[model samples]
Target: MNATTPEDRPFGTVLVANRGEIALRVVRTCREMGIRTVVVHSTADRDSAAVLAADEAVQIGPAAPKRSYLYPPAIVEVALRTGAEAVHPGYGFLAEDPDFAEICARNGLVFVGPRPEVMARLGDKAAARRLMAETGLPVPQGSARPLTDARDLAAVAREIGLPLIIKAVAGGGGRGMSVVWQADQLLPAFRATRAAAGAVFADDRVYAERFLPGARHIEVQVLADDHGNIIHLGARDCSVQRRYQKLIEESPAPALAPGVLGRLTGAAVAGARSVGYSGAGTFEFVVDGDDVAFIEVNCRIQVEHPVTEMVTGVDLVREQLQVAAGRPLSLGQDDVRPRGVAVECRVNVEDADRDFLPCPGVLTEFVPPGGPFVRVDTHGYPGWRVPAEYDSLVAKVIAWAPDRRQALARMDRALAEFRVSGPGVRTTRDLLREVLADPDFRAAEHTTSLLAELTARRSRPHRAG
Candidate 1:
């Protein structure tokens, strides 16, 4: 199956089937791993910073992802042409696609993620929930099947109670999801969610679940190998979010009770073991006070992976390469002890007050922060025109400190130093400043819905000095 045996075939050159900051992140690690990298780019991304960072770059197709990044055979061809032995899909766009992984395997190219079977098993949320529940993991009380037309409205309503979430079976990153507050809104919510899901994922299947109000969006970054060895890098507090997408994240979630930490870690391991989960993946959960319930599992590296890496000195992308090469995880559970606190803020190009709308344009004024405790991961410059075709995340600034308060102060200072500007671009930086300065957030007394309420309250916009 694998070229040569698991231990023999070397993980040589890697083809990064992604763009932007993640591609650059992987390329940097590949440089450290002494492995060459093949960077694939769409026409719109021909001048992307990641292309310059790679050992070799390839123009795959037009600007559309379906023609470039999502086209498996074309991407594989690029890998073959460039002598790339493996492929690393960073987060979105074919990262969790099972058929793509299988295709890479058949072509004798390593896919830097879990096996195709694992992805297929966990791709569907309802199915994954059932499997995890079978292993005694705590999953939300939800329907097993994607709603069958919402025909039995009353019965379904009685089953899931009020204030339930209507989610797409194949949803991720909050795209194909809707929340229902009352019985009257259920059918309309389901219709809208189904339409959105069909448009986004080609899956019109919708499911219902009891929404856990005030649950913290906590997750564990897990590393595993082919031989079934697994370990957890401490949890991240991603409670600061809007519409299920995290805005800021920090390691060693504050305010968790004594026994709650172990339970969260154990449940994550159990979920990983359930689908024979391997490679670097994240298991997201909604922690209701001290009680944790499984939300979903991301089978690829996440946007907030840096916080965990900063706190625990593990090069996740490098480890991902090693794990894909069929190498056993070099570090055991004890080796993953957390040392310091790390916080990451995602700087998105969006107008925060105008319904958080995307603000894409040329970077007229771009300046990133720097200090001993700060690290900025980005691929944009002053002349770079922010592409409207992709996600609005421009860059990430991470701060590390020996303790939470120091990390908080370092991040606050870094945010103040950081600056970005363009015509009519409304950013979340000022919004983040307000949220970070909040007493509840400073105390870590927040949840996934924190931003929703924060935005609902009047925000006095403060321009960067």
Candidate 2:
């Protein structure tokens, strides 16, 4: 890899890794920038919107992610075979995998993310926590290192105490974690968490931390160029979640303290700079009543990133491209500020009344929301087959407004406008409606477990048809 400056990235063919909405999102921007794109996919995503939109398409493997998207060597081989100059990993799968990034560089392909070393540094939440703590960031209080055994974990948790979070060293997207409320459950929790971590990431190095109950999830979006210029695109409030997975997110948290934004943003930028970070990344924080602590930083773009883009009018995907091309971030921090409130609800192919069970099939009919202040990022359409083998996410419906209430109203209206159905498919539209109408959400007094609470309170013995 050449050490060219940010403004010198190659403007040739780019291959897209991963699939679905994010893939289409990258491809559209590449076309707008006059860069040709090639789409690589597993058999399951062969009929996905991304494959149809790209200039060319290539089949890398079978339907499963492990066989296709996660196989770096095969992806690199496809890139080499297709003559693409760079590979755009649109989050998930290998987007944050440093090994894949290194492979891309070794194979003469621009990885389109931060340097591999930086990724390795930030990908491990525990290591990043210690680094940020050293860098003057307000990180959480937890095991400084990954506990080696149940006794070691118990000893550390005894230090941190009960009602703490047991986190995997290398974890993301709410996976590889467990919450223990009692000291007696430590051993069982540790064993289960270790099994989960090992099964998912092949890493069972786990740690413990004081869990912040009722904490709101806050994150800052930062973009940096190779020329040493880094700027934040404000924050997102992802407090509405279920099973530790986010369902609804909005920009400019409505309940944040007067000066909290500056603090989180500063820490986010400071943490990014600590690793000499480049490309687009998000610094996540768990917020208590008025206290904040750095949780983890996502090394790539997020699912709700479109909400920030909608309100701020910053094309994160485009900036990612330019940064990969060795181009300085076109806009500074001041220029990327939010103009209005934007809220995003993930439209998943799941039955709302059925424990959010996956409901994948061919889309018999589909129509996304559209209007002023409304943005729909999707990779599904009429006649598209919704694969059950991957994520349940089908689209992100976002709405922007000048104020929080207006944004909520607009989001409700947008949800009403959404029309998605299949021969035997169910969506979370009704559940989202319940969430939007919840008094706690409307009053801006909720946390990460709010949705699950609401769901459990209303969970019926059987699914409502």
Candidate 3:
């Protein structure tokens, strides 16, 4: 690999348009690359770690996300006012919004992701499916476009069979999705999903696909540059999820048939090149046995990125910044080699026993685990209050080892050492431990339904002897 010189630096100053761990994560990478950072936060996060670590900080709005992080105009204004040369929208909020990218471009500030046009086309799940299918990627059997009405949805659902998934065209992060198993339950599920989609994403368009009950949720990480260079960093297994939300993720998906990984990575790279995609993105797929089907693409840094970094030894954020600056990828496909096994667990401030309900309060004590091959990405600290206005994820604990068995053991040890407490505060630490010890997970045979099944077993009533 080549060293980045002063001239190679993408932007002298970058404005981070998000909050919590992702904001802090971006600031850390920028500092290492000799770039100054400006972070915009709501009033509730005035004392956040990202704000404290940044060279400059500004208050954008109140606690509400809509008035703060999701408001593109205010964030663009901050970047311009602060003299930031670029804006990095980490993961959520306005990360995938093409209009926000265009606004940044119109103001002469670089948006550290794909071009606005490409983002707009791929941001729509239905459209992305069509494009990927045309590019020779295997797409699930479903509607090729957004359903027009109840009749259209029913027609597609019938064609796709009884068990199908209703997904919002503009949905991500597990919201606006429902699985209908019974024919009688189709319309109600459609109505509820559409309502939730409109309220959350502000777009109500939806489509249906055949649901895979016993499938592994795998995603390939890819990085592209404007110079027509793209490479896959490998794949992550995000099968351990509840309510379609991923709780744990690991890289180099285990127990795959021979050549499955290669096929998935090749398809991802081809799909990215076909759409002229740039920056860091993820291609999510559902794998049932030896068969794989394309789902959607995440056109930004993912939450489980650390797992990829652990095994690949690549700084994805650094690559994103360099690509945004019109630089070709620093390395090619031949230079990319993944080693060992890595696992990451999202430690959220939620009570797992109470149906994963969010528990927010002041933290009386916060101590993350530390040791060899263990990384903790978080914005929490002692005396810092856990705000209910944002996502419940307080920290991410990652462990790497030479093999999957050791990695799981290391993660369990790290989770055991994680000490966090406060008034009315709870976390999913215990639940994650149980998952790490599951028999099916140990054999790498677990599917996306593992978490739900675990919860169901826990909720069953025991007969008295």
Candidate 4:
């Protein structure tokens, strides 16, 4: 509650208002920095690794996110009750919720992120697109505002030509998004996307954009402090995705065109500074050849952030905490020297053969990969039960090396070493392995559409037999 500078204010205690590996990730950093941590969790995560690692753990509610993690009031009450000075909404639930951030500010608890107004501006896809355009950055041609109705949407689609995409103005991670490849698909796609947006984000605002199916997904990691210092920690390619969800990510975007990374990095810092941003954020773009178009800004630390950290040697979460406490960035742009290539594979507890359905069960046998250049971030253990109520991601396995080739080889070895087994348990490990070995992926010619190709060719069920 004390409005003091970061250097004078002791950020001694922090309440983690989320669960899973991200919560554990934050807790680890807080511990290393000598900051006390309180973890808020649902019944599903009572026995999770994050809870065990925290200085204190509080049961907020049941397994349902709405009643627990997403319930801002309960989270705020818990922080106040625990005497925590700040609340860290580790990605996913409430991580990008501007209202929650404002609520934290109003209740005198530091939100370990950007200001609420800044989050609102960047969180809205359409608004972010407009902001990016104003910065003189290239943005995709699309609806400047939320389309009025299906007729308006149809008209815009016709003008933009076929194969355009309808996106929820308030959506992310591919949810509330629909691709319309033909004129007949416009109405259905628009209405469906609107309904999805309302259901997920409680906002039915929809916009449209030209679809670039083969473009690579590149995003730059950005850090900004309260003092107006913003810098980028290079870029990462997350083109290996399925259903708009990234499954694999790599840093330095192997084989990028000359001067592209520099441009992307510069634009990202510019975008962040344009909004007077703070804390950790990402500027996502769709890259086609040398032309890059801004897609959206992820106003929170991302799941694929480890790839950037692996190469930059910057602990983004640590910086985020410091920035939230009003500290300037520990490193400047000149100091952010990215070295080596890093690849990350998200291990999900899903049946890749059955259209990637969630296959949750006890992990009777759990073994994570490890080596000189490999790092695994997970909250699961041998006896831990994979909860069906939450996201299927169980762990993130990352590999780093001096070059892309060695990084890929190291990732393959790490995947081979990762083991998980139980009834009804199927992971994306084998699928990721197959994708990594594909000739197109090795050549770095894969795009956001690569998952569709892999899915079509999937013939075997990946089971831990």
- Give one digit per residue, the lDDT tens place, for model 4 in 1-465: 334444543388999988889999999988878788999999999999999999999999999989999999899999999999999988888989999999999999999998999999988899899988999889987889999898888778767787888999999877899999878888888889999999999999999998999899999999999897888888899999878999999998877889888889889988988899999999999999898999998888899999999999999998998899888989998898889999999999998888889999999999999989999999999999999899999999999999999999999999999999998899999999999999999999998888888888785566896
Highest lDDT against the true fold, candidate = 3
**Which residue pairs come into collision in candidate 4?**
none
Whole-structure CA lDDT of model 3:
0.94
lDDT of each: 0.87, 0.88, 0.94, 0.91
What CA RMSD would candidate 3 show?
A: 1.7
| Predicted candidate 4, C-alpha RMSD | 3.5
**Weakest ten-residue segment in model 2 by summed lDDT:** 1-10
Cand. 4 TM to true fold: 0.96
Give a tens-digit lDDT track for model 1, residues 1-465: 223443443467899999999999999887766777899999989989999889899998998878988888899999998899999999899999999999999998989999999998889988888888888888887787777877654466787777888888888987887888888897788889999999888888878888877788889999988898999998999989887788999998888977888999998987898778789999888888768888788999999999998989988987888888888988999888898899999899998877789989988899999989799999888878888889999989999999988998999899999889988665778788888888889988887888988898855566798
Per-residue C-alpha lDDT of model 3 across residues 117-199, encoded as one tens digit per residue: 99999999999999999999999999988987889878987787869999999999999999999988888998999999999
For candidate 3, list the clashing residue pairs, or say none.
none
Candidate 2 similarity to native, TM-score: 0.95
Candidate 2 lDDT over 347-414, as tens digits, reads 99998668889999999889998888888989989999998889899989999999999999999999
Local error of candidate 1 at 43, Å?
1.1
RMSD of each: 3.7, 3.6, 1.7, 3.5
